[model samples]
Target: MQISRLPRFIRYASALALAVLALFAAMRPAAAAPAHKTEGELSYSSHSGLTNSADGSTGTASTGFQVLLPDGTTRDVNTFGEAIAIAGEHRGSTITLFEPVTLSYTVTVPDGTTINLNSQGGVTYAAISGSSEPPLRVESGSTVAIVNTGATQVARVQNPNGVFAIENKGTLLLGSFVQVLVASGGTAVYGNAPQPAPGAFIVDAPGSSRVSAVQVVQPENQTAAYSGSEGETVVDLLAYVATADSGVTVPVFQLRDKPAEDPTTPSGAPDNEWVLATGPGGATVSDADELVTGDYTFTLRPQGATGDYYGYTVTLTVSVTMPQTVDELRETYRQKLAHALAAYAEADYLADDWANIEAAYQQAFDAINAATEETAMQEAVAGFQTAANLVPTAAERLAAEQQRLLAELDQAYAAYDKADYTAEGWAEITAAYEQGRQGIASATSIADAQAAQQAAVSAMAAVAQKPADPGTKPDTIPATGDPAAIAALMGLGGSAMLAVGVVARKRG
Candidate 1:
């Protein structure tokens, strides 16, 4: 019978164990799925004026612009129509211009697509139109040169959202356009455009782009310019404008060698026309061959006659300063990194906090190591300092622990009574309590605070009772004057009297 029941017992035990395991498994949290990362794709194509319609033609027409495809392939796009067709086919792709091209037809860029015209690349006599607001996004370092001679408008961007949106981070050279509706997104517009009508070049939502001001974006301090050891200097200028009618002519600025020279003179002679460096919308003028020294001025020239910069000529003088050597820049970065590392070593932080600090430090170190220029190295050092400032120090942690320990000690002191315990016992507790308080007051680290807290807890537990007086029995009788003693005497007398009466009665 025992052998037969053994299998049943084993089966029951196995089933019970499995049930418990399943319960625990159901209660456990599920693992999170890994996040998917999307890679950016670029397409290269040139603007070739071969085909003039969006008829889906895949011919080998070569536009100066190159489209870099996701599969690392190049496609030739000749006409603005072909460019638009290719852009529509590959959404979120970039069409890079390698050579200057002139297109007479309107270019309507598709959504999520970028048209990049490099420093050497320019698009002339093309009208940019959009089906939706912000149908085209002009990337930085591109130039959209629109020279409208006839009554045709340069750009007419309209969307169902009731806003004509064209995000232009590059330069918009509006030359003699009858009407150019631009949503510059706060970028500047250069060249003169006669606002022949009231709403010719309307600066829509957000901010206006009607050339409010022209300022230097680089040589950060207008008074100082950074010059390389080889005497190469770079200066960047940006024009700020407000929303205005096309009737308002856009202001134009010119760089000159001499400040007293006439601003109205056309930039044809080498002496008058300073070589404007090719870059993003913000004109980055650089003189690599010539060693620029002292202060050079840039003046906003008047457009025609009546279209001056609102009678106020904007001028900026930029002084050239000697650039720091690579070795000097490295030294500066090393010193900054050393300072941050020293600070990290002196402070104690939790494991998680230390991990964050270490990661930030590593990034800064990598940045400095990879940096070859003075600006990049300086940026690395500055970034490291900013990151290091956010880490919590050991002193802060110790201070918090000390505050907690002090509060616990105060509570312990409140619960203790000197009269309840013997003098020797209470004295011992008092000493321990004082020691704990002193430890807390003098605590310099988290460990010291913890030790102080332990001492306080021990003092709370060391409560001893007062010792009993000598020669005092628990069951001893009371004195004569006491109430208990009087009751005892009266009982004794009554018992004796009763005994005497019984004896007398027996004698009788």
Candidate 2:
């Protein structure tokens, strides 16, 4: 009984020790590590016919235009000039600023229109005004400027909405949440908490350097934001209305509140969806796959004319449907390969050239046969098409080969006439020659001509090794018109070897 009690006491002591060690481990703090970040500088440029479509309906500087509506619908603007004159038909009509287009006249935004200023180009918002009811929202980028100075109640700042300003001689009434980059000589009137808030009023000495910024954010816990002298911030309040393309109109943009930027953190890629289109038409757009199945919008600006440098606009909405099914795609590829193969087979394939080509075709065909899925089969078909186009036209190949065979026949006859042979040997030689000549005359292809050429070479060989006449002396051979010529022909040279077949016989 005492021994059992001792064992229980030892177990309790071990458990208590383990609990003390766990508590000590929990008291230690973890080592902290600093986070790393990266940022990219904003770049700006402008170009013409930036985007166009296939089939030629819309093009850069081309006659027709298209307006993208809010509901993913498009309005065709018959001419570039017509598109610029009429305000858009829809209430939430929106237009994207693709390039800098100088306005011939002042443009006004009706009650509820928004403009999206893309980040890729420097745009000048010259002589522009928004209706007092629902003010225009502009999404700014690297280079964008608003120049307006005539009205009252003209600007109001809605935090997280947009920056606003009212006009004075050199004095301007700025909103509460404003991001400003005071350029050289640009001055601002601070609005204090007890009085008005700071950075609420800014004045641009009429002839001072214009201010520029990528973005500015409202400070935390402050009634009014500060007016810092640093002008490196990039602002983004993009807005535009073009009179060309039959009054292209866009909805008022919903500008976001300026946010604080940590110096240590890196910036990211621009939030703009604009893409540069190189060629005239055949514009394709998809977020991930080739067959897009939902509604999407693509904006295109025709490359500005080379000499005039005036850019054009085309905005369109497309609803992509699922293309072919796997089986359907397989069938299409099969048909295409079949057609190519048929065309190639009808062509004349030179024996030397066809050797490699035939091997390549067979490889592709084998791949197709081994394919277990649609993609693999499609790849095989592509390989086959590439090989098939290399074959030459049948007529051209046949003519070239026929001429070659004709030359060989002439050489064979010449060699035959010079050879010394008995009457029986001559008869055998003549029969084979006539057979080859007929084969050549009637041949319609390279293969047939090749066969004919081979037969002629055999006739020359038979004439060369004809047995001596039975009555003639064994050492006395028939007279060869030219012994030297006969010896040269027998020692086949150049293309002569092409005609001769290998046989184990000595020359007489």
Top lDDT model: 1
Clashes per prediction? 26, 56
- Model 2, runs deviating above 4 Å: 1-324, 335-372, 379-407, 410-508
Score candidate 1 by TM-score against the native.
0.27
lDDT of 2 at 408: 76
lDDT of each: 0.49, 0.41
Model 1 stretches with alpha carbons more than 4 Å out:
1-318, 321-356, 367-383, 467-508
| lDDT (Cα, tens digit) per residue for candidate 1, span 246-302 | 122233332221211232332432221222333223344454334334444454344
- What is the model-wide C-alpha lDDT for candidate 2? 0.41
Evaluate model 1: give its lDDT.
0.49
Best by TM-score: 1
